[model samples]
Target chain A: MKQFFIKNRISLSVLIAFLIFTGISFFADYQPGKAISKEYFFQFFKEMIFFLPIMFVLIGLGDVWINRDKVEKHIGKDSGLKGIILVMLLSMAQVGPLYGAFPVTYLLWKKGASVRNIFIYIGAFCTIKIPMLTFEIGFLGWKFSLLRTLVSIPAIIIIGIVMEKMVGKKDFTIKQP
Target chain B: MKLLIAFSVIAIVISFIADKRKTFSGIKSGMVMFFKLLPVIISVLIVVSIVLFLIPQEMIIKYLGEESGLTGYIFAAITGSVALIPGFIAYPMAGMLVKSGVGYSVIAVFITTLMMVGIFTLPIEIRFFGRKVSLLRNLFFFIAAILIGLFISLFYNL
Candidate 1:
């Protein structure tokens, strides 16, 4: 119990603060604000519950089954433009909030995927995913959405390369827990 | 969601048949990852709720055109980083902002950063990528968001 509390102290305090604020809002008669906040909170919670398990399951399966050699060959240091295209396609296929991508990203790192490709995966996952694109087109017009996609492709690549360069040849380790 | 669940189910079934021990180990790692992430994710969501309470939806809408010149664009960018509206709602809101004479550039910046650069998800990101990479990732996207806005405005009048 003590170890758990110590490890999770930051989150516990934040949770407590949330409860206190909700209580204060309840007392101060600011019902609407508190209600809306709660509504949004539950909505996101629902999304997290829906996606996280399945996403992590898939990531774990990949961790066990996917060969490091394959990851290195496809998205590794010498993979070049093909790796870029591949990561973009991989990211586009995903459907979730950005947080869900992190585990998969970590898995790819452990499997020897290149830094640039990793960043590209993240950049593409967040921005140009297929489902989000259609919604954007439906609401913001196909032209706007297409233009954004067009602009995003090169921008994502550039940023990824820049990130790789900024971090230099140094590759840091993130322990698998 | 249905499609994802279906695929995961198929994958799990196949993996279990192929090698039960490996499958179980895979699932164990996944569960460990899930529990590790839950606290940070929950705390982040709670903080997000606080943001929603303070700013509210309408206030975000209002921020788009409240200031003149570059300040309005900056405000829109900052609001995009902070606000957590879903894409369905957010895209339509962008349309509304455009209709209300907010430039496409500002709207571009708003949506780009809104999706790519999550202020609320920073802690979760730090957990995976560390402080420097996460912060730099957001910073790069922030600058890219601005440039995306400029490019969109340059390419199309609408």
Candidate 2:
């Protein structure tokens, strides 16, 4: 129990802070603050509950089914443009929150994906999700969507290259678990 | 949600058929990863909720609207970085802002930073990638977002 609390100290502290805020709001009769916080909490909670399980299961499946050599051969140091494109497509095809991308990126790193490719993947995952793009076009117009997409793709690639240089080649290797 | 259900079902079926032992072990490891990640996730969500509670919608619209000038662009970028609204909701909000006469550049900056920087998710990012890399990535993205906003504003006359 003590170990668990230690491990989750940050979460525990945040939860405590939230509870204190709620108490203060109730006592002070700040109904709007109280109501808004509660509403936001439940909304985020629902999203977490819905997505986290699926994300974990998919990560597990990838970990088991995909081997290091296969990943390295495809997206590793020597994989080059093909590997970058592959990562971009894979990320763009994904349908979930950005937080869900982190675990999968962790798995990819462990499997020996290059730092450049991983950064590209993260950028693409953030901006170019297919389902979201559909909504973007619908709401923001085709011109806006197309222009953003055009600019963002090259921007993401440039960021990836710059990050690779900044972080250096030595930091690319995964530390042993 | 539909996508989540579909993917989960597909993963379960594939895992069961491919190799039972591997599937079980994979799931076990995945759960371990999930638990390890839980603290950061919970903290980030709570922080985001508090931020959302404090920043009213009217304030956002007013500050990010057309007449607010350069300060509006900066405000949009900063707020977008901190706020954790999903893309689906952000689009409609952006549309409303546009309809309400907010500058396209401001909206562009807001959307770009919202996707790229993720101030609320910084802890989780730092946990995974270390402080230097995480901070640099966000810093770089912030600059890129501002540049993108400027380009959009210039090209489209917004």
Candidate 3:
């Protein structure tokens, strides 16, 4: 039981927090905080319900489908600028939370992707990619979409350069700490 | 009460399956992770709801309407930076902004940059990526955000 609790600390913490909040909410006055809390509770659950299946499938694919070695051959640091663009494209293709990109980025690092390229991947993951921007342009407008993409290009390059200078080539490795 | 009962039943069934499959570790750990995320999840919800309730669309339009000059620009960026909504939420919000005499350019800049740059997630990003990288990334993003805003403003102004 102790081991189980330790292992599931994240989940357990959430459960405890939820229960505590619920209890407090029940007794609390009808202030803005309480009202907002009540609304949030429902909204949080709704989003979680919507997001979970997608999260799980992505997790499963990470474990089974992706071939880190295969990706590395074409996009490793040794491949230079070409490598960076390829890796950036791959990162753009990926879905899920931006954090979900980290493990994959770490793996690519081990395979010898430059720190600069890793920065590109991270930047691109956050910025609008082709897949998502299409919907965004339709929903919003083309000029808006185009401007966003334009801004992102330079941002990605600048981030790539900055990351290289700050982190250097020392920290990135295949070995898990 | 209804959702609580439903969730509890699902949780119980999941736990039972884990017990039977002897995959208790993964299932148990997943739950624990869920529990840990509870605080942030709740806080975000609270903030979102408050924004939704307290910040009226009319107020935003009066201040941030297309013809409002630089104030409109700053307001759009501030609103975009602080607001945390899914793309779906943002899309309709943008549509409303356009219809309400708010600049399409402003809406575009706000929605695009909002999704890309996160003020709320900064601490988390710093914790995960370290201060150096986070600072650089965010600084770059801020510039990108402003540029995107300016470009849209110019484009639609024409």
Candidate 4:
């Protein structure tokens, strides 16, 4: 219990801060956001609350479903280009806010995914996801989305290669003694 | 309303099943975990609001406007990185830029790098991933950001 509390201190601080801010916003004469409507605010909160369960389920399943050793073996340097591509694709499929990504990245580290590949995964998670791309296209236009996607692919690849060399060590993998 | 209810039901069911399975500390613990993230989520929202409130759209155009050329793009990418708006806000802002004659390519690069690279999240990232890994990753993304913009520009023209 103590260790768990220690590990989660930052998250707890953020939660406290959020509660205080929310309390102030409710009590004080806080001006609402301009572009965001009151209706939109409620709706966004509603969606977030609604999505929490799904997120929990996914996280829970990942804890059990993911094969730690196989995940590492496949993504290790010895796994070569195909492994890299697989790692990239899997990372791209991950969803949620940047912070939401950390738990999974930590899991991958525990599981033996290379730190370099994890960097690439994080980059791809940011840039190369299909849903994000589809949304970008829907909102901004196909030309903008396509251009962004094209650029991201090579950039993620390059980032992966460069980081792989510079880091001088793969992340904690099952292959490690 | 029905769709909303349906989604809620699905979420509840999933949560129940997760609990039943006793996985990852079950549904109640998961809910607690989810609530724990609320502060980070709220902080992100507050920061987005701050950017919108402080920075005028016109100023963004002047610096990141099409007429500004290569320098404009670099400025735009940096601005986008620092502004820290969500994609929902950023893309529309990019649209306004386009209507105001900002290059599509610049907006593309700005949004891409803005979402991917974290100038603001550096401390947190360092804590999570260690310094060298975080530094190398962020630096690589920053450089790739330039090429991303340039490539988008060419691709659209082609």
Best by lDDT: 1
For residues B110-140, write the lDDT of model 3, one tens digit per residue.
Answer: 7655766666555445434666666666666
Q: Which of the CAPRI classes, incorrect, acceptable, medium or high, describes model 2?
A: medium
Whole-model lDDT values for every prediction? 0.85, 0.82, 0.60, 0.64
lDDT of 1 by residue, A81-151 (tens): 99999999999988888888889899989999899999999999978999889888887888888889999
lDDT of 3 by residue, A1-94 (tens): 5855574465457557756766676777646547555664466557655554334333333333346676666765566777767867776665
Model 1 scores a TM of: 0.93
Candidate 1 chain A has its poorest 10 consecutive residues by lDDT at A168-177
TM-score of chain B of each: 0.92, 0.93, 0.65, 0.71
Quality of candidate 1's docking, in CAPRI categories?
medium
RMSD of each candidate? 2.1, 2.4, 7.0, 5.2
For candidate 3, the clash count comes to 14
Question: How big is the positional error of residue A61 in model 4, measured in Å on the Cα after superposition?
Answer: 2.4
True contacts kept of 1: 0.64
Name the regions of candidate 2 deviating beyond 4 angstroms. A1-4, A20-30, A172-177, B66-69
True contacts kept of 3: 0.18
Candidate whose DockQ is highest: 1
Cα-based lDDT at residue A99, candidate 2: 78
* Per-residue lDDT of A126 in model 4: 84
Best by TM-score: 1
lDDT of 2 by residue, A1-177 (tens): 587788678778987887788789888989875775678876887888778867887787788888899999999889989998999999988886777887778889989898888889988988787888898888889888788888888888899889888895685543211
